[model samples]
Target: MLDSGLYEQLHKALWVQKKLSETVARHWVTTEYQGLTLSSHFQPIFSISHRRPVGYEGLLRASTDSGALIPPPAVLVLPNNSKENLELDRACRQLHLQNFARQETGDCWLFLNLNSQCLVTEQPDAGFMNRLFETTGIHPSRLVIEILESEITDRSYLKQLIKHFRSLGCLIAIDDFGAGHSNFDRIWELEPDIVKIDRSLVQEAGKSSRVERILTGIVSLIHEAGSLVVLEGVETRREALVSIAANADMVQGFYFAKPQQLISSNHEEFVSVIDELLQHQQRQRFKNTHQINENFRKIERLFKRAINHFSVTQNFEESSEILFAEKRSVRCYLLDDAGYQMARNIYSPHYQQTMDVRFTPLLSGDNANWSHKHYHFRAVQHPGQMQLSRPYLSVADSRMCITVSQTVTSSDKQFVFCCDLDWQDN
Candidate 1:
């Protein structure tokens, strides 16, 4: 083991690194990313899918007062000094405003790492955030306060802090989620707007099912609670695609763009990239919409014909084969009034297993039983509601889809029919 002198020396070395990071962060206004001279120190890496604003993550890189880009992460891990951390945060905010102004974009929130000490000091300067907003001309709505999950985090105060930020019109985010031992339960208590999946959890998405399951559970849990997920530190198309398929609302990683002291210009190239994504989304959307419309029309026609079938013998074994059997892909299920499974198309891969399925989750809505699923033609729609299940991958075919449940009442007796729509086959 090292002696006290060596330990002290190491601490001093850490402080030196800390000071260098501050120097670099202080120069954030002059950092460049991909040749785009960011007028600010904080750089935002975004999702390539919808061009929707994710969060602007602060990067502690600095082009020298001498013009050299200081490395990141090390700058952050040098030493956890509260005062220094606060200063770093402030400088990051300043640079964040500068970059916000340059982009001519107003919706993306700037996610500045927060110093836990600064939060619990019982000394929130009322004007601090407002002034930062005023200086940056970034609206409070466009600011997200990012709290790193550290040992010192106190859940009670964290809740208070998140509520306080929200009171100021700013959003709250939990950064580096699932990386450390902090209480993720606070996320639910605080009701934050964003829950960023830590890079470590996302790093081995391809090789480790264990990693993927953990990542899946984290993302799914956050999404279930109504918060958006940003798959942070995405480094590969595979990672991004997997996260996207898992329903992540946003993604950030080096593959998209690395943090730089300066941002790359050539707006034309960025614009073209944006255009291509938009066109692809548009076409995909069109195809999905067309498929759903055709299904709806077919369903309407089938339902009119099936009304006689519904009124007759409840078991579809004979008539369904005579009617929908020719249609191949369409699926249907029946549930009794007591929430028990009934029957469905014999060909349905899941036929007769159970009326209540696992793939879709139902939610309550305007009608006693109406819900929506995400579809190609429509991002979300209730169609005709029985008990609407949110979208999920169908277990039978492993395809993205949603199931709609509705009750058909003849003379006050109610019977439920749940219809499933698969985007893959569509």
Candidate 2:
């Protein structure tokens, strides 16, 4: 360790410059703090389309002199004095940068976790990280500053800190989204370059199709907000497949690789993993497409017959009985060209038994305008061609269902014929 005089000199030189003493090893950098060893480990983040590692998130590892490990939570617990916490956070960041500088990562980013304490305590324009970047010879563009936006209560301070980082050419990422009290407001306000979805959401997706669809919507919304989505904590093949199906931009977790000090040179290992996942997704997509086509064929036959009968006799119930004969059919209805319901829904007997009385107010569809729905507008857009919508929660019965619709011109009046099918089983 350097003497006290040399320590100040190194601090002036913009080295780690904290309470910890740094020791540069051959392959990595290490620091000593209260008799524990601090080191950096990285978990790879791979782009789904690129089929290779796009970047790595730096994780701090704390161990005893004898190599006994310490849990990350215990290691990162805030000290009673906020000053010590800030120093530790900066020290860990510097350690990560130094180790990353030695790796052969080639144009990939180094994602560093930024503690809320550091953001609150430091001056935004202090140029501390800029000086550190100069000392380590790492460009600011190569760094991704990860912040848990929920932890910072002061939106102004958070924005100022992010602005300062962006001014330095560092990419900003909202970390742990969808965990607790996370909303799209910050995403709209901060407009981060990347958003890391919390692991719990992905885990729940593996067990529930509803959660999986919700995940896909979340990813779509994030994309609409102009940020890439990274699904973290993917530990199983099922979770990885879910990520792919959800259209996540990137993924990171134990399923791909665990955190380690050395970056691997063999990129093909991860490429093969991505290739296999893509193949599985393609196969599943083909199977689902085939099933949906068969369903549409059956529904098409019944729908045309129903349309013909209703057109001539003007009887909704008698015409829709054939459609209600399908086991999955829930209800059938008709809408005018402007999307106002022309009549009450004809509910299948089996579906009527399972209706939730709590949603009785929404049971009647007469005069309700469904112009905003995809089923209505899509049929209007395609004219005579049938439209099938993805499964969505139906307000009429408060159950998950898919809608099949087609526009029909009968007796010179245009109508949109729609049928809902129970999606709980299929």
Give all candidates' CA lDDT scores. 0.58, 0.88
Which candidate achieves the best lDDT against the true structure? 2
Candidate 1 shows a clash count of 21
Q: Give the per-residue lDDT of model 1 (tens digit) for 214-256.
A: 5777778888888888878877756765565456777777756
lDDT for model 1 comes to 0.58
Candidate 2 Cα errors over 4 Å, as ranges = 1-27
| Residues 139-218, model 2: lDDT tens digits | 99999999998888999988998998898999999999999999999999999999999999999999888899999999
Candidate 1's displacement at residue 30, Å, is 6.1
Model 1 spans with C-alpha error above 4 angstroms: 1-42, 45-49, 52-55, 63-69, 72-81, 261-426
